[model samples]
Target: MPRIPAVPDAEAGVVGRLVYRLARRRFGSVPEPFAVARHHRKLFWAALVSELGWERAATVLPATVREIAVYRTATVVGCSWCVDFGTMLQRLSGLDVDRLAHIDEYATSPLFSPAERLAIAYADAMTAQPMTVTDDQVAVLEREFGRAGLVELTQMIAVENMRARGNHALGITDQGFDAACAVPQGRSLDGSRTP
Candidate 1:
């Protein structure tokens, strides 16, 4: 259970209920964060809008690179909820989630591509306590991803940091999103199987 209890559907106002219904339709359940955020109406809407905006705006980098960096940040922060949700997202995107087992050895792991390694390393630097991000790291990322892509990468990492830390502090652990909705083998989010 979270340190702060999630608002039950009964107590959720009209807008909250509508949001919860939409969430359930989209994610198979209303995410605990949304339930908890419902307590503060303005902040809840702000967070919702911010999330949607980022989702639409963050299209510069390849999903694989962006997702790996976000997942690495979640692991580094030790946020179980973020890790669980990130895993589900990756799987839905048709990425190989099995390679996540080797994330600890990302620096030397053959599972990750060169671009993934760079992004993962950047995530580590950004998530460090004192923020160990370096000029060389940014320069290399810039050279690889260009200015627009680099910006999107940075924003994704920073956003994940905020989410992971917040969820950790709030005592929000994994809600089993990955296990609850298993995408069938070779199937995509649209229910179409890929070749």
Candidate 2:
């Protein structure tokens, strides 16, 4: 259980209930973070709106590119909630979820393309404290993605860092997004690491 209990869908009043139901339908469950955020109703609405806006904006990047970067960032930060949610998103999008097993070795793994490896390396650098982002990393990212794409990638990684860290600090954990959500491909039934 989370440090904060999820606000039950049935008792969240009309607006909360509707929001909860809509998110549940879209995501296969109302994410635990969303439910906990309900304690601050106004902020919850803002967060929901902001998330939707980011989703629309990120469409400029291809699905595989965005998901791999996001997933790598989440894993680097050790956010189980983000990992679980990201795995489900990848599965729902029909990306190769099993390939994630090779992510930690992306530098040498053929499973990740050149683009993905670069993005993953950048995510790794940025996630580390006293960040190690180098000139070569920026140059490569800028060349591959252009300035705007680099900006998007940086913002997405930075945002995930904030989210993952916050969720970890708050004792907010996964809600079975990679198990109970839409037949997640690579998660064990007990939510353990699965090969």
Q: Candidate 2 has what TM-score?
A: 0.88
Clashing pairs in model 1? none
lDDT of 2 by residue, 32-110 (tens): 8889888888988888898888878976566787788888877766677888898988898899988887786789998
Whole-model lDDT values for every prediction: 0.85, 0.80
Instruction: List TM-scores for all candidates, in order.
Output: 0.90, 0.88
Top-scoring candidate (lDDT): 1
| Candidate no. 1 TM-score | 0.90
* lDDT tens digits, residue span 34-141, model 1: 888888889999999999999999999999999999988887777778878889888888998998867868999999999999999999888887788999999999
Q: What's model 2's overall lDDT? A: 0.80
Question: What is the Å distance of residue 156 in model 1 from its true position?
Answer: 0.6
Clashing pairs in 2: none
What is the Å distance of residue 159 in model 1 from its true position?
A: 0.4
